[model samples]
Target: MSTETSAKAPGGLRTGVQKFGTFLSGMIMPNIAAFIAWGLLTALFIPTGWLGVEGPVEALRWSGSEGLAAIVDPTIQYLLPLLIAFTGGNVVYGHRGGVVGAVATMGVIVGAAGTIMFIGAMIAGPGAAWVLKMVEKLWDGKIKAGFEMLVNNFSAGFVGFFTGLAAYYWLAPLVKGLTDVLGKAVGWLVDTGLIPLASVIVEPAKVLFLNNAINHGVFTPIGGEQSTEIGHSLLYLVEANPGPGAGLLLALTVFGVGAARATAPGAFLIQFLGGIHEIYFPYVLAKPVLLVALVLGGASGVATNLIFDSGLVAPASPGSIFAVLIQTAPGSHLGVILSVLISAAVTFVVSTLFLLASRKRDLAADAAGEDKLAAAVAQTERNKGKASSVLGGLAGAGAATATQTIQNVIFACDAGMGSSAMGAGVLRKKVQQAGIEGVTVTNKAIANLDGTADLVVTQAQLTERARMKEPNALHVSVGGFMNAPEYDEVVALLLAQQNGSAEEAAAEETATHDAPAIDFGAKPDPATSTATAEGEAPEGATPEVLTRDNVRIHAGSATRDEALREAAGILEAAGAVTGDYLEAMKAREETVSTYMGNGLAIPHGTDAAKDAVLGSALAVIRYDGGVEWGDGDVATFVVGIAGKGDAHLEILQSVAIQFGDDDTVARLKAAETPDELYALLKGGLA
Candidate 1:
């Protein structure tokens, strides 16, 4: 059962929706903890809450002070807006933008009389930050040397003032109107028994990583308004109902095979208790058809809530079952619990059918006999080699032959840390047990992969993306990251390759005919290769690109630009490139910052600035303090490249493969001497 399926919508519409969803999710996801805190506080201390007794008991709630409710109320009213503002601003302009965003949002909060101005904050925050960014761009290079701070402060303050005014005068009223309309529409849907239809959008959006946006941005605000009017709001149950997700996972736990069955139980706990919806996202993605189960489950849960007239007094921030119960109305506990059970039952039945069908298909394929299956697998392996060769446009025979020795293996995923990390650990253990030497195993975010790995393992849902990022690597798609069967298959393939290499060596020794030797280490000449070699550096380029003098063991640099210059200076000193290369590298940074996650950054000049390169070379600088490369990503190692053509790509690929290994990355970060770093790098390439 191939995990790869067409789940995304066709081109333009999908791209637009995805971009908008990502932007909205970015604004809310980072502040989920704050939201959860607010939700818990509201659930515990509000008048309708279990512990929200009035009179002397209320005074006891805070040791005879105004009461814990006093603190919770103000935090929800004030802190939540500030958090939304800061997150929106940070998304647009970083820390400075965050400040401006918060400042601008306060105006809307003060202006709006009844509403909390949730949507208003979203608008004012990003708007204020964008204005500040534009003003900074206009002042770039024009500001007097000693007065940069003065100009920047005044410009930001000026933008914030106007933004605040605009929010008070225009944006606040506009958002209030929109919020009221949405709230009324949602209330109508609930009244008419049509709220369950929301599952059509919510289920798909959740799978697309937009759960936070829909919950916090759209639903939470409307739910809050409705809850204020009534004692509780069914809108809160629309997205936060954990029943559907819990049901799907329960089914997987019972009937799923391999990793799905093993991980589902733990994932269920996390999803049901921790309120992390992301735990079940990969499961649905593994089989897009399971989306039907999710939607039906969600609808059933909503319908059950409708039947019982159950509602929550506040939003369930993590959408955890605990949060749902805590926020449920005083007399609605039984109804809420029943709703969850019903949803779980519906999802389990549907998912079991899908699982059985998938299993049957796999069994049917396997029944084709061992020899036929082996031949098919071998053909698939050969196709992968050909694909790699096509991507590199190198000598086809050399590229195909090089696949025999799998040096670097990477397991890539959407976020890189969760399933991919676990998968990489599993593979690493298997490789060690099998006594595979000189092989690097690692994991990375699919977007950050640099096409340097010999093998790339990823979820079937992300296979197309992995192919795009690392076209030269052999791609392996699996249903789940924790699948023992898939890992066993991978191990068997590696063992077979190793044994095949030994047999080939024996055959070569006994052969009577003379054959030309292949040199895998020699750089491919771009001029002789196809279009795939368009950017490749010529053969016989600089032999000593990275020298001892260019290596800085422990460097001190405060910012990304400062580190870039320091590394570039080393390349200049080495006569690899002229000083003009620094500007070229900076210019490239403006286009796309080279901070490649995992504490590594590769700063290189643009192709247009090839004239600045005297010869191909590299500079390695390590910062113990770690320089911030924007967006909270910090880099300990800054590699500056000054390659004239595609010649430098090989070195970049080697570095990528090296960094992919967690052990190597950790050792490089802890390396005490320049020699140690160089040795690691050299050994990785060799």
Candidate 2:
């Protein structure tokens, strides 16, 4: 029955520093810096005469003194909260439903009844738990466990919606009031203490090499309120060292390889012709050690620009080589070329060495059999059925048919609602996008659900339960349902199911067979245990998967603390965080839990187990039911070890793509489990 290639994860010295460093790179600065940079741009440029400028002529006619005056204006206050809300949301909740989700949620938080949304978020999980418990009492033992997750997760989303409302209405005012109070206090201190101290340090720093005329005068990639000057300096710097970027491109071609290498062509198409160099961001991120290299190269180019007294008369839109050439001082092409060459040479050597060393470490670790606990999903082939056609045609197709016999979806986690429900939302979006219709998806806690499913997807710890419930369902192990490839394959499988249904129906018609097509109602076992038959499943028992393609990982932050502490504060301030969420997550983690990998993980499971995985995962199995994946690349395989029950063989392949890859293996070995795993995954993904 076991097809998975069992291997232990690599165990070695934990690289805590590197892990934290990666976390800083991924979670802390990237977006925060962007927000700050854009805020300053909005603040400085809008107030200056630049806003009213008509064309290149007006833009070129700006007075430096006037621009400097507008740059420091205090009207730039509104942007701070926007950044905080967006960034805080992303950090806490990992949802980014575009500016709408963040901004609208922010508005709800700041609305007339804004505190409701915040309160709701605080109480969502706990309230959902209470609701589930209440529902459990009403339902019979046969269906109570199976239907628990659907009820809980739906409640969680409902709670979050109201919480967001509270946040907009009630919390915003309190926050604004607190900000004003803090502002006054800080102002008093700054006027009395900081201004004089800053005057001494700032004036000296400006006079010393920090603000030397050449260094200060040339363009730089300025950030904060001083960004205009920095941008101006950076413009000149790019001209001076055209070599650095080109060299980085060449290096990217070598290290990134595959789709990453193809970035060169994409960059060429966008940057060379289109003049958009933003295509380079992924390349920069993929090999983060090269970040220092890029910075050093940029500085070198800036220095070269200052040395050569290079200048740019016009703002370049495309930021391509041609754009640089056209904008640079006439006949300074040689300086540009030399600067680029030198910068590129420096970048190449530094980046190449870093990449080689990292790769070498990965190979060594792999050879030593470390981090193998997280091997790729075992590849296997099995007969799969399609019920889409039956759904498409059945006039009386009820909820049971919608759930058990239709599509290739297995909500096979311990506490299916928390993590599996979110994953289902993602899957539904993806399946819809793939043009597959008449499909149903639902989660079943391992303790229930007869074995009539197309595929039974469950966490590692709950495999036994899934096997017991749906021995007929083709079971597959994917550490967790939320990660990529697993979700992607689930979509593919649904699509295939629809296709298979069509083929089965067509073949039946051709052969003139009178037999009904794969009738779920006829199956005595599934019929007896159908929770949907009791009218419990969503929208008439049709559960859908949540996908990255559609479901947004909205932005937010959450503190590591007791649920009552976090939830109660938000509820008290906003009137929404009502339920006991920490208890819910802990409860969820206990049964058929979501813990999967060492440095990687996802906490989730069916609702049947005593301690459900609370919809998250990190280190060793958070609960007793969780597996002890001893040694060998445990860091990389954490997420994949959780949900071996709800997924199919293909999703396991997707886990391999995400966690079983070379880069993931190396990163896993170089990081701590749990928190560090989340950081590395976030960084690599971002």
Candidate 3:
């Protein structure tokens, strides 16, 4: 697995911020369930909570039990720090790193008197993992072959021990001091009624995927301390506010076009009800200008809290509105509700303007046809070229062309579930429908990818990280995990490769170094020709709608029109069409580019051009350099169709389903012989 980080920002300071934010998010997001559980315990059993009831109802209240109340204290001090330590270390160096991190955190807990040990845990966890990783590198290949396990265990133990001692003597006190200073500074902000200004920092960090880090790492410890002093703290509500994210989604639901409009309502429900704030991160990323709205909305919500002086009795684990309501102080319900409403309204107004502007731009681009959209998509990918370089040597190689059948396809993400799981499910159904065998599709946390997968799919933001985790796997990044067009592309490539294996093997045997003399407008080879010796359809032969004569290898067309004409010429020679179909096909292309992702395109005439069809026929042409088919999409496989009525629709659908398997499409693209391409296409229809 590669360990390279994503491309660095232009400035060192910006790069550092990006790394810090990503690292912090990685450590806390996975342990959110634990945080929620802790919050529930604190909210229910604290002295002021429901468990504090002293009447006959006390029987139902665990707060009456001294043991239960005691449970909250250790949980707040110990459990969270331990979780953070393990997660941080695991991310850096896997399970062994987790063990060392947990061991090192013990010293920080003991030395700091358990005050804000989360800061200590963060330091000690990664510090210990780094030390252990260095030690392993130093001893790599030096340990006796049979005694590797013994050496590894003993070295890890020694490193953890010394690291713990170092934390106890030096790091703990230093971090504790810093934590105290930060706490006082925040307290001053609250006292001055300027706490809302903190949203300027918090909102941007949350958008950078640092919500979990800020809430769990920074705010939770400070909030816990404040709650102990005054029974609740507004600091807990600062980062956990769901209003800004909810507002953004609501705006998209009402005025956003395309996929955003369809997906926003579901995302809103998950975020506002289920507390999965990550759902909205991609939306903000797609249109970064909306960061302005998030920041303003967050500030407005914070201001509302300040006005009402609203505070939660405990942290809201998922930051869900329901959790907020549950943890709200007795008299702060109205204020809390108002905060959410105000933030949403602010975000909605700003987002609406941005959406309108974006819609206008999209309308102009659409009028230009798919070529503009394709070009835009291509440019976006080009911008990510630097970040994608984290794959290092694996970028253009690895499983992309590997002949070994893809045994495992893993959809990886930061948290593993949510979008990754949904993507995996969608691809799984497509794989099943395609009759793809011997392949396992699963979703895993990016850090947990073990390099066993043949292919890895992830959100573009995390592609670098995913590549680092499984460098040998073919990595494909998409805009969003749900409803991604890339899924179909990946599936097509996979199936093509899987089914084209035999053809590929055979072509290798016939490989030759000698190049045939070039002949412009040369007649087709008699052995592979579609027409009879008289330059007409063969007598008394069944029409082979897709035959060797209808297949063009490396046509190398300079434009979509040229590629379509080349393909149509093959069909006409095969006696499948009688009239000029080029104009009709070009008319269709004007309306929508025939180019689909995965380097394939289906160019056909309009319904009225059915008269040009003598019978249902398909022409497959391979363009080595690929013709530009509007926008930025290139069509390597220009499949020209001339069919009567709806006769060719099923075949078109089959072609779509076939190309959707990325492996098969890849194999098809690499096909060297017309026979090889013919077999693959015929097998798909069969």
- State which candidate has the highest TM-score: 1
How big is the positional error of residue 349 in model 3, measured in Å on the Cα after superposition? 4.2
lDDT of 1 by residue, 329-374 (tens): 6556777888888887888889889988898664454455222222
User: Number of clashing pairs, model 2?
Assistant: 147
lDDT of the candidates, in the order given: 0.65, 0.37, 0.65
Residue lDDT tens for model 3, 1-686: 32222322233544455556557656766776776666666656666555644312456655455456667778767888888898777655556777899899988988888585878888899789778877787766577768978887898899899999998889889988988998998888888988888888888766554455566667877887776555567887788888999999999899876555656787788889988676676567667888899888988888888888777767786789988988776456778889889998999999989988889875555456322322222223433221122122112222344566677788765534234544565566566555567877766656677778888876554666776778767777664332354555555556667687333332222222121221212333322222111223223323345766777775223467677787777778877777577776776554334454566777776444657777767788887645656433456777787754323433443454455556556777777888887766655422
- For candidate 2, the TM-score is 0.34
Please, what are the lDDT tens digits per residue for candidate 2 over residues 155-190? Answer: 445544655565556655665454345435534533
Each candidate's TM vs. the true structure? Answer: 0.63, 0.34, 0.54
Segments of candidate 1 deviating more than 4 angstroms:
1-11, 54-66, 210-213, 229-232, 253-289, 309-319, 322-332, 353-362, 365-595, 598-614, 617-686
For model 3, give the 10-residue run with minimal summed lDDT: 385-394
Q: Of the pair 2 and 3, which is ahead by TM-score?
A: 3
Order of the predicted models by TM-score, top scorer first: 1, 3, 2
C-alpha lDDT (0 to 100) for residue 447 of candidate 2:
43
Question: Listing every candidate in turn, what is its Cα RMSD in Å to the true structure after a full C-alpha superposition?
Answer: 11.9, 19.2, 19.8
